[model samples]
Target: MAPRKKKNASQIGSVSDNLPHNMGPVPEIIKSEIPAKALKEEPIDSPLPDSPVAKELVTPAKVTPETKKKAHKYKLNYEQSPFPDHPLPTPEVAEEVHRLLSKEHGQRKAPTKVPPPSATKSGCGEVPDLLDALLRTVLSANTSGVNSAAALQGLIQTFGAVNGSPNWHAVSQVKPEDITKAIHKGGLSVVKGKTIKNILSIIHAQNVERRDALLREKVTGEPAGVLATSHLTQIQKDAEIARIKENPLTMAWIFEIKKDSEIIDELLKLPGIGVKTASCCLLFNMQRPSFAVDTHVHRHCKWLGWVPLNATADQTFNHCDLRLPSHLKYGLHSLFIKHGKTCYKCRANTNPGSADWKKAKDCPIEHLVDRELTRKPRKRRRIEDSDESEGDSKVTSVKRKSSGSTVVKPTKKAAKITQSKPVKATPSRPLRASAVKARAQSSQVKDDSESEVEEVVSEYDE
Candidate 1:
């Protein structure tokens, strides 16, 4: 490498001076000498008035802090629901329904308050374990209370009970077929059994994971385990199992959630749990304020004009949950069920001329409902047979007589056949015994085939 000669100070100064003239003034290389706190305290520079950036820049308005929404302790508020707009029934209407139902079908007292998890005891008045309550609700789906109770009893009898509760863990271990047999009386035994089995399996799996995690933490003094070992003694394991049996399997974890929405969300993650099922658990089991719409509730709410005509049970629940007062939730739910079951006028699928309908008195809330929206009874027609003879040809007629007198004419094909061939006019005479017998046999065979087809159609309908 060659050594470079050093330039004079005057030459360097001359070059620097010429560079500025040729390419505008050179900007100073400023250093940030101010402390971080001082820089933070300094106001930010605004764009120059004549600059394009200034023209594009906008002065921001002073930002005020948003007020935080106060959360409800037990009830959920759906701020922006997708359901159609409709006002909920007035509190007076709800009260009236409750009062009327209480008179008709004995009054029921629902819990008015929900205790904290720490104070809650697993018993009649207190909230039940999540898993137990869920299982009972599942059995109650589309079934009468008596059948659901019977099914629960059968489960307790077969799998055995601990502290008056069925041993769900034992039930989980058995085959789904066994569960089906146990709950056969509840109806939809196969589907209910599978759903229950799936739920138990999921809960049991979660329990095993928790147990393993606890074991790992205790044995290794670390968050995770390095090796699988029987670190917990058999006695300790048995004690934990017994504790689970005494309490609900999911109670340890699920009850930790404080928000009603979170609890409902967690429940909705289960196999057979829907909005209605989850809400039922919240209202009845957790004693939380929730509107759970069943088929009966949905029908009644529609008739009452509280919800839109097209609203589904789930939509009704969501709409009513937010609109109805929290205090009335339990009472309204219980009363609605009672009224639907006992009141012939309000009951679903009630025929107009049925024994129950004929005996039922006027409904208490009949004036409140829109009678036009209710299902009307269908008009039945009476069928009659007629035989007419024209010359030697006999015509058989089957007529259906309704409220109005109208005779059924032959079909187009029959009419066309009659027009195509004209019968000869001849003197009428008594038919031979063999000919009459043959004709009778042919007619009987046709009636038998028609009856067979009608039977198949009815079976399919069922």
Candidate 2:
């Protein structure tokens, strides 16, 4: 079927240039008002008189399709794909109309601010339990799982019972000055000391019943903020995560199916969170699959030409989400940050360098990843070759000595006996070859010991 063209931004139709010198012979009223000196011819070298009609040269353009198209001043949308061979879907007018109407209706009635994170039953999937979520969040920050697990185990061993959830007093009992005893190995205790206290405080503020209320309440109003209290340890959402979670332009905002402005207001109400934090949180927590581009992510995305160089972090994230895949968004966010940190050129904030920018699959993202799912580790290719080569090399290196011992057929036990036979009582000065054999034996022993440690199981009170 011939593709129907909707109105593009091309100029409607070319109007003739139709330039004329005189419409009414320089109007009689202007002639009457002219002074005699003004009517006199002016000298070219003299200061020119202030004439009302000071004309500048403008060549009349020709009227061909090319000229007409140029005159109309049409250019493709910057975000639009420009390859003429690859076409995109034309938007349905009815759907477009419905979208516009829904937007208009929302604007007319929506609140100026996001109501509190009213209690809701669903979101972020069957989300991790609160405590588990916090552990994951904290563990995820600037560290690895093995270390984070070590820290959590340490905390549990000291403070909590066998089940590991701390009682209110369990948290309160840990002296602020000595909180390091609980999280020292964590290496994140510099700030985590306060985080522990904060969690305890929330525990205090939210009695089991009140906690339920907070989680379930659908009330749309001002947020209570990260509920802080003297009785509580005072852990609120950090300023960073809260800010990113609140962006009006964020997918969460869209998911909330509310006005962009509404979600932004609710996010700002968070104690520590700001715009950037809210934006990030909205994508990460809400699973809206946004780019959630942070500072590191912002620099790298643009350098790869996936986005404009001048874009803000949020813009970079939005542009990427639009262009990249769904499963890949979060991975892209984390990987970009990792890549930015690892590859200096990608993160060059002040002094720039040329990046060997690769595009997305079509070299579009211009890097190993733009969205998270784009990154897939390469498969090991040389394993079979390595095994074959190693076997061949060993066989080749084993030459029959000139002493040319006869190949004697023997039963397995007899062959083993011959191989294990002791050398004759030759008087030995310390042999360098023996020392090498001894060193290899000792190294093998150490490798076995280390492997045992890796496979070690705890003999603990169950």
Best by TM-score: 1
What's the count of clashing pairs in each model shown?
Answer: 0, 38
Q: Tell me the whole-model lDDT of each prediction, alpha carbons only.
A: 0.64, 0.39
Q: After the best TM-score superposition of candidate 2, give how far the Cα of residue 299 lies from its true spot, in angstroms.
A: 4.1
Cα RMSD to native, each candidate? Answer: 14.5, 26.2
The local distance difference test score of model 1 is 0.64
lDDT of 1 by residue, 232-337 (tens): 5546544554555554355545554667777787777679888888888777777778888888788888888888876767768878777777877877777887
Name model 1 segments beyond 4 Å from true: 1-77, 99-107, 112-127, 211-248, 352-359, 374-407, 411-414, 417-462
Model 1 quality (TM-score): 0.59
